[model samples]
Target: MTQILNGARKCFVQRGFHASSISEISAAAGVSIANIYQYFPSKEALIIALIELDLQRHRSLISRFWSTDFSPKAIEELLADIFLTPEGHAVAVLRAEIASEGARNPHVAELLRDSETGLIGSVHSLIRAAQRRGQISNELDPDLITERLSLVFEGLMRLYLFSPANGQKLIEQYYRQFADTLRLRP
Candidate 1:
């Protein structure tokens, strides 16, 4: 099952959701199409599974933040690692493919919506915790803050995708400016 998901993710990232065929995924997975179908009824099902897997990974990443001091520097570091690293670039590519599919497919759009909702909820909780710790301004509304932060992340991803060469520097500068706004004022 993991192999199938990994294969599907690779094929989708390389060839896009529509261009990738079951045969290609089967070859990538070292499994027969019959085996893949036994686990995932259709390509859409594979997409859902991949999204679910990404959600789980995101949840785990959020939990790590929960355990930390919730400092602006910590947040900046996390964001940099996610958006500026080589592994992160691959993940970002996959995310772009998923987002493109979402634009054309209602079901994929719904899944993406659900994933974003879950992410927002997690980030909202993180914001609330930071407020309690006096690391973030209590004047900020957690929900609104979470939404805007999500937008910032999406923008960062887009920027990185568009300009990989300058992504790290741009992300650092943007995040520093954004983090300054979030920090509790002396």
Candidate 2:
């Protein structure tokens, strides 16, 4: 199953979620069609599994982030690590592909929503911790702030996927401005 997932990830990364075919995944996995179907009924199912795996990884990353001292600088550094690297771009593209398909596929949409909820929960926890530590303003509701932060990230990812050069420049500018704005102290 792990082998199949690794193969699917490779195909999705190389050819995109929509363009990647079952045959291609099978060839990459060195698994028979019957075996693939036994594990995953359809490509959609396979993609959902991949999304779950991604969510687990994201949760792990956020958990680690939350374990440390929460501050605007820390948030900025984490965001840079997540959005400014090649691996980050690949994950962003995969997420964008899933988001596009989610618009058309209700199941995918539900899965995406679930993943987002998990993301928001993690961010909200971090924000609340930062607020408690006087690292960020307590004026705004943490949940609302977390949602807005998520919107900013989604916007950044969209720009990054569609326009790389402009996106990198914008991310640099945005991260600086965002870090300053999010900081409670001078």
Candidate 3:
């Protein structure tokens, strides 16, 4: 199943969702088409699996927020891990492809919504925790903060994708601004 998912991801990244075929994925996986069908009923199912896998990884990363002392440096590291690394760039590209597919596919769109909901919940928890620690202002609503942060993250991903050369600098600027805004003032 992992092999199939990895192969599907590679193929999807290279050829996109619409152009990638089950046979191509199977060949890339070094498995038979029948084997793929045994695990995933359709290409859409495979895509959902990949999305779920990505979500699991995100959940793991978010969990780290709870274990560490909340600080601007920690947040910056998280952002860098998401936006600046080679693996991060690959995931961003794959996410863009998945998002494009979701625009036209109701099932994909629903899955994306579900994924976002889970992520938002995790972020909400992070905000609440920061508030408890006096790292962030308690006067602000966690729900609102989570929503705005989600928007900022989406914009950052777009900036990184569309303007690679300046994306890192722009992200750093945005992060600094974000850190300043959230930090509690004496």
Candidate 4:
């Protein structure tokens, strides 16, 4: 199942969600078409599964950050890990694909909504924790802060995908600027 999902991701990235065929996924995965069908009923199912896997990893990263006790140093590290990296061009491309697919496919859209809701909830918790510690301003609504950060993330992904060669450096600069502008207090 993992192999098939990986293959589907590779094919989708290389040929796009609509253009990529099951046979292409099978070839990429080095598995038979029949085998893929046994695991995933259709191409859409495979794409959903792949997105689910990525979402799981993302949640894990967020959870790890959530588990750490809040400190200025820890917050800085978390911000760098979350905002300053491109997460690789392949993953970025895949993310774009998923977003576009979500717009046109109801199933994908629902999955994305659920996944994003969880992500936003986790981020809101982190922001509230930081506020409690006086790392972030108490005046700012946590929900609004979370939404703004999510927009920043999406904007960075777009800029990165536009010019992947300089994406990491650009992300680093953007996050640095954002951090500097923040009124974080001890």
Please give the lDDT score at residue 103 for candidate 2. 93
TM agreement with the true structure for every prediction? 0.85, 0.80, 0.85, 0.82
Q: List the candidate 4 regions with Cα displacement exceeding 4 Å.
A: 64-87, 180-182
Candidate 2 residues 1-186, lDDT tens each?
999998898889889888999999999998987889999999989999998887787787767766555454665566666566777777877877777778988988888788888788778888778788876788858776666556766787788886665645756655565565476454
Candidate 4 per-residue C-alpha lDDT over 1-186 given as tens digits, one digit per residue, 9 for 90 to 100 = 888888888888888999999988899999999999899888878888888887887788667655565444564576455444554677778888988999999998999999999898888888778778766678878776666656776777677777776654665655554464345433
Report per-prediction Cα RMSD to one decimal: 2.4, 2.8, 2.4, 3.3
User: Residue-wise lDDT of candidate 3 within 58-166, one digit each (tens)?
Assistant: 6787677554654556666776776677677777778788788789999889888988887888888887877788767888787877766567767777777766666
Where does candidate 2 have its weakest 10-residue lDDT segment? 177-186
Worst 10 residues of 1 by lDDT: 177-186
- Model 2: lDDT to the true structure: 0.76
- The TM-score, computed over Cα atoms with residue i paired to residue i, of candidate 3 is 0.85
Stretches of candidate 1 off by over 4 Å are 70-73, 184-186
Q: List the residue pairs that clash in candidate 4.
A: none
Report the error of model 2 at residue 116, Å: 2.6
The weakest ten consecutive residues by lDDT in model 4 span 177-186
After superposition, candidate 2 runs with Cα above 4 Å error: 66-77, 165-171
Alpha-carbon local distance difference test for all models: 0.77, 0.76, 0.78, 0.75
